[model samples]
Target: MSKAKKSIEVEITEKKAGNGKTVSEVYIGKQFLGNVREDDNKFLMTTAKNESFKVNSFDEGIQELIKEFHLHH
Candidate 1:
């Protein structure tokens, strides 16, 4: 028997929303995953999977998202 492989390839793109606010959108292949944005100097992330989180630093926000999604370095 052979072991099946499980994998995901993510991509991020930075752009401006309708309000001209900066946002970084995350994608897995061609599927939209989530997004991160800055608010009041803090970083926030929202996902299409019903996950939302906020942090005081941009780096922390990104790290938390990686943790939440179980992504490996």
Candidate 2:
């Protein structure tokens, strides 16, 4: 018998905010994860629960959201 391999997948999409700036939307499966926006030279990440974080890069923003999701779930 063969065992099934399980993996975690994340999706990111670029969206236009009301102010006409681009933001990255993160999703885990079908659930909405968070949004990462570039402000000055730092990336601002905001979770679905409205929690916020300031990161250095887009990848860091996504990592923060994933950490929050794992902590909560």
Candidate 3:
């Protein structure tokens, strides 16, 4: 069997939330994964699956997304 290649793309943009706060949007390919925002010097990741995670850094947020979506580098 052959292996399949996965492509995970992230678009970091300033998107205004309902509370008027800016958050970065994360996407896996063309699918909307979740949002990552900063709070108290920590990053908060909210996934599309309604899962939330408090990560230390922005990169960590991406890692969490990868794990959540079962994707790889």
Candidate 2 residues lying further than 4 Å off, grouped into runs, are 1-5
**Residue 15, model 2, lDDT:** 91
Can you write out model 3's per-residue Cα lDDT over 1-73, one digit (the tens) per residue?
A: 9889866566655688788777888875677778888887889999987788899998898778768777533
Indicate whether candidate 2 or candidate 3 has the larger lDDT: 2
- C-alpha lDDT score of every prediction, in listed order: 0.75, 0.91, 0.80
Report the C-alpha displacement of residue 13, candidate 3, in angstroms: 3.5
RMSD (CA, Å), candidate 1 to true, equals: 4.5
Write model 2 residue lDDT over 1-73, tens digit each, in one string: 9989868899999999999989999898999999999998889999998888889998888888998888988
Candidate order by decreasing TM-score: 2, 3, 1
Off by over 4 Å in 3: 1-7, 71-73
Q: Can you give the lDDT of residue 12 in candidate 3?
A: 59
Superior by lDDT: candidate 1 or candidate 2: 2
What is the Cα-based lDDT of residue 37 in candidate 2? 100
Which pairs, if any, clash in model 2?
A: none
TM-score of each: 0.64, 0.86, 0.73
